[model samples]
Target: MTAETQLPQATGSCCSPGGACHDGADATTGGVTAVYRVTGMTCGHCEGAVAEELSGIEGVSSVKAVASTGQVTVVSEAPLPEEAVRAAVDEAGYAFAGRA
Candidate 1:
């Protein structure tokens, strides 16, 4: 099988990973989606690390990171309190460069 066929697809609700509900709309209570651009991301590993960091937040529903552009889109069950997101980025050794 090709690499594409070998990878397992992720299954998640609107609140789960890789779900399609990240347009500033709340996934849990149907609130709003929050998109942020992170800085200091340069590769797939950086994206993975950032995604992992965001995923650890309590209210974060999912994290999509595009390493090429250093962009990170996050969906939240509720409003993503800035401090929380910032903390995650900081812990991951990156800088949260506001929303893009």
Candidate 2:
């Protein structure tokens, strides 16, 4: 018999199933939108942690993390350095897989 691993369902209006929180569009006015690949995110909590850490960086306007897709979208006033982004992801207990 094979044991199947099940992931916990994400709650909240944004992370919930079939939620259309982000359309994956670059809609930042006078800002830069960067999509980065992240690993070790398996639930909403992980998403929140990553977003929080990234959001703490200076010039960061907003951050959205989708655990299911292992993608993090960041909107900032200017282009951020890869080292900065990587440090933020590492602080969140995740691996930064670079730009997506």
Candidate 3:
């Protein structure tokens, strides 16, 4: 599939007041939202690993990973410490490219 096709759309409606997704219910606090560039991810396995790792992070409520671009977008109910996110990526054997 094409790169565009490979990317998973953000789950639920994000910006609409009447959207299914609840606002701030699953979002990060401190006005901090991040899209991290995760390296060493080549396939579903990598994606799964990254997703799983991020899921365990405290305050991290949602994570969407795109393997083709090694990108992971995370949303949390509270501001997630960057160190925590970085550790997740590193522990998963992937390189963290900081916020993008």
| TM-score against truth, every candidate | 0.70, 0.73, 0.68
**By TM-score: ranked, best first:** 2, 1, 3
lDDT of 1: 0.69
Encode model 2's per-residue lDDT on 42-94: one tens digit a residue. Answer: 98888888988998888886787988889887877778999999999999999
Quick one: best TM-score, which candidate? 2
* Root-mean-square deviation per candidate: 6.5, 9.6, 6.4
Candidate 1 deviant stretches above 4 angstroms = 1-23, 26-31
Where is model 2 more than 4 Å wrong at Cα?
A: 1-28
The candidate 1 region of ten consecutive residues with least summed lDDT is 1-10
Task: Identify the leading candidate in terms of lDDT.
Answer: 2
Could you tell me the C-alpha RMSD of candidate 1 in Å? 6.5
lDDT of 1 at 25: 57
lDDT of 1 at 14: 68
- Using TM-score as the yardstick, the better of models 2 and 3 is 2
* Candidate 2, backbone clash total: 0
